[model samples]
Target: MDSLRTCVACRRRAARDELLRVVLSGHRLIPDDRAALPGRGAWVHPTPKCLKQAVSRGVFARALRASGRLDAGPLENRLETLMDN
Candidate 1:
């Protein structure tokens, strides 16, 4: 069976494969497309709406157990590019 995870932005539980995994690298957020990144990771729906809510509401830091704010620009750009393709 597939594992399940909760989306930090929408607060909905979904299958692991249905969501995108995000990890922290220094002070920036990185998208773990393969979910192979080291360190604490947070899951979120791979949607623009979820991404916006996660960033605006500062959910990634909380979910990842990261202190203070984290740079989400890289994640945002990644999502944008995915949407474009």
Candidate 2:
């Protein structure tokens, strides 16, 4: 069976690889561009709108099972870079 995960921002279930992966690392939220990082993870559509929604809704923490605020700046930048490639 195909693996599935839900987008924390859009809250839609899709193929695991179809969504971008984010992982918690040292109290910071890092985007797993290659989805290879370990630890708790969160999923979201690779779009600013979804990222914004996820941030504004404060869902990353819960999804990643993290406490306090998370830094998604790097993730956003990485997304932009990936999109540009």
Candidate 3:
């Protein structure tokens, strides 16, 4: 059976194939589109605006249960690159 995951920002539950997965590597947030990362993941709508909204509203931090501040630059950059491709 396929796994299902929910987007923290959009509050939408979707099949594993439908959402974008992101992970926090130390102080950086990186995209794990293949869903193979072994850590807490934050999901967004695979859109740049949604990514921005999640970061600005602190949803990503809350979802990951991260105590320290998060660096959104890497996340935003990865999202932008994905959007471009």
Candidate 4:
């Protein structure tokens, strides 16, 4: 059976493998596609819709305990590339 994780955007529980893992990287949000990055991480679906909602709702910052605005550009680019792959 697959483990479950809650999406910070939609607030829905889903299989861990089905969700993307995001970690804080010096005030920036970095997508951990491999889920191997260290430190606290936040889970979200790998879709721009979810990402936007998460950002608008401040879920990423709250979940990661970020002290400043999170730069999600890199993470978004990574997710786009991952979706293509």
Number of the top-ranking candidate, with TM-score as the measure? 1
Q: Summarize candidate 3's per-residue lDDT along 1-85 as a digit string, tens digits.
A: 7777888777888787777888888877788878899999887778866787787788887888886778888778877787788
Cα displacement (Å) at residue 30, model 3: 1.0
Off by over 4 Å in 1: none
Show model 2 residue runs off by greater than 4 Å. none
lDDT of each: 0.94, 0.85, 0.80, 0.91
Writing each residue's lDDT as its tens digit, candidate 4 over 1-85 gives: 9989999999999999999999998988999988899999999999888988998888999999887788988888987897798
lDDT of 3: 0.80
What candidate 4 gets wrong by more than 4 Å, as runs, is: none
Distance from true location, Cα of 23 in model 2, Å:
0.3
TM-score of each: 0.95, 0.88, 0.85, 0.92
Q: Name the candidate, 1 or 4, with the larger TM-score value.
A: 1
Clashing pairs in 4: none
Question: Per-residue lDDT tens digits of candidate 2, residues 1-85?
Answer: 7689999999899998789888887766788877888787899988889988998898998887778878888887877887898
Question: Ranking by TM-score, best first?
Answer: 1, 4, 2, 3
